[model samples]
Target: MNQRYTGTAIFLHWLIAVGLIGVFALGFYMQDLPLSPDKLKLYSWHKWAGVTLLVLIVARLAWRLSHRAPELPLTMGPITRMAAHAGHWLLYGLMLAIPLSGWLMSSAQGFQVVWFGVLPLPDLVAKDAALGALLKTTHVTLNYTLLVAVIGHVGAALQHHFIQKDAVLSHMLPFAGKA
Candidate 1:
């Protein structure tokens, strides 16, 4: 069996990873900005990024469903393997949830999402300032949760590389070959 993931999978993974970081950071940076033209623009960009990420994640999930991932390292025990799988699923869930939460928050705040400033997305919920506040909190909380999960994911990959000295991390690296 191949030691590395398919090229398409690697591409989508990195693309989504980059998008996640950009959108997450933008959200953090813009949340406290005083309402001005620039802040409004930043918020629009953030929304666009979030919407784009949602599409990318759905595509990634579909691809994952269709394509079997390379097997885990043989050295990992059953419990470790289970944890890894659970961690991956959690990441996927957060990836999907965060954007939807943001979108719903925007909707509750009566702001329409315009994808890439071209396509306008429908509101997900009725306008309610209270609900908007709650969803904003939910979105922030989920993003931080994802941050923790991502740290764990990266740590596990590093452990595989440095401690186990396995090809696990290499499996996802671009242009990586058999170990």
Candidate 2:
């Protein structure tokens, strides 16, 4: 099996990484702004970006199911393999859940999600202040969860590249050599 992911997979991985980082930064910084038009504008960008991530993750998951991913190195320990699998699944779960929660929260607040000035996403729940508040809380909570997972993911990648001197990190890079 190839040790490096396909070009499409590599592209998607980096694209999502850059996008998610931008979204996270926007999310964090936007909250500090006073209630004003600028803050609302920032939130608009954040919301669209989150929706984009949701779409990309769904597509990535579909592609993954159809194609075999690059294999781990033969010398990788069982614990490492387990950790890798668990981390990936956790990332996948969070990626899907966070955007969904955001959408639901917005819908509950009676706002339609406009996807990058394109189609409007339908609401998943009825309008209710209490429910909206709950969803908002859930969204914020999941954001923190996502932050931690992302930090762990990045830390592990750096560890593999620097400490283990393994191709685990390189495999996700577009220029990585084939197995």
Candidate 3:
């Protein structure tokens, strides 16, 4: 069996990774900008990226369900294995929750999500300023939480590569080989 992720899996992973970084940066940068055409345009782009990521994540989940990921190294302890699994699932959950929360917040704020400035997405909730404010907080909190989780995840992967001296990180990286 192949030690690395399938091409499609690797592609989707990197695509989503880059998308997340871009959208997250855009979101933060645009948030504090005074209301203007540029701000509105950035919001639309951010929303579009988020929607695209939602679709990509769903596809990723489907692919993951149908295919088995490589087994964890035998040297890792049961507790460590369980923690790794939990961290992965947590990432997936955040991936899903963040987009839905943003959509809901948009709806609650009386804004419709126009995907790529063309397709009109249905509002997830009725307009309510109170709920919109709360969802805004929820979305931001979830984003920071994901940021922290991602940092830890990357740290763990590096730990495997540098400290554990294992193939754990390379297996997920396209064109990567053990050092």
Candidate 4:
């Protein structure tokens, strides 16, 4: 049996990872910018990226649900295995939650999300300043949570690859070379 993720899975994983990083960075950078056309453009791009991420993550989750992921390495301890499982689900949850929260915040702020300046996405919530504040907090909290989780994930992968000398990380590498 193949131990590695399928090519499509690998592609989606990397694509989303890169997109998340970009969106996160853009979100932070744009927040402090004085009100201007440039900031508005950045916000639009940020919304577009978030929507794109939402679509990709939904597809990724659907694929994951239908297909089994490789089993944990035999060498992994019980605690490590449990943490790995929980961490993965947490990542997936954050992946969905962050964007949903953002969508809600936008809707509450009475903003329309136009993806890539093309497709228009419907609001997830009604416009209300109070609701927008709450959702904004939720979105920021979730982003921070995601950032921490990603750090832990990277650390675990590095541990598996360098310290444990295991296939845990290599199995997910894009150019793993020779099944």
TM per candidate comes to: 0.97, 0.93, 0.97, 0.96
* TM-score of model 3 vs. true structure: 0.97
Clashing pairs in 3: none
TM-score of 4: 0.96
| TM-score for candidate 1, residues paired by index | 0.97
Q: What is the per-residue lDDT of model 2 for residues 1-179, given as tens digits with 9 covering 90 to 100?
A: 66777777778878888998999899889988999988988888999999999999998878777778778877789998998899899999999999999999989998888888688888899998899999989988998998899999999989889988878888887776664
Residue 70 CA displacement from its true place in model 3, Å: 0.8
lDDT of 1: 0.93
Scored by CA lDDT, what does every candidate get? 0.93, 0.87, 0.93, 0.92
RMSD of each: 0.9, 1.4, 1.4, 1.1
* Model 4 Cα lDDT, one tens digit per residue, 1-179: 66888888889999999999999999999999999999999999999999899999999999888878887788888998999999999999999999899989999999988889988889888899999999999999999999999999999999988998888887778998643
Q: Candidate 1, residues 1-179: lDDT per residue as tens digits?
A: 76677888899999999998898889889989999999999999998888888999999999999988889988899999999999999999999999999999999999999888889899999999999999989999999999999999999999999999999999899966776
Error of 4 at 48 (Å): 0.3
User: Candidate 3 residues 80-160, lDDT tens each?
Assistant: 999999998999999999999999999999999999999999999999999999999999999999999999999999999
lDDT of 2: 0.87
- Per-model clash counts, in order, read 0, 0, 0, 0
In terms of TM-score, which candidate is stronger, 2 or 3?
A: 3
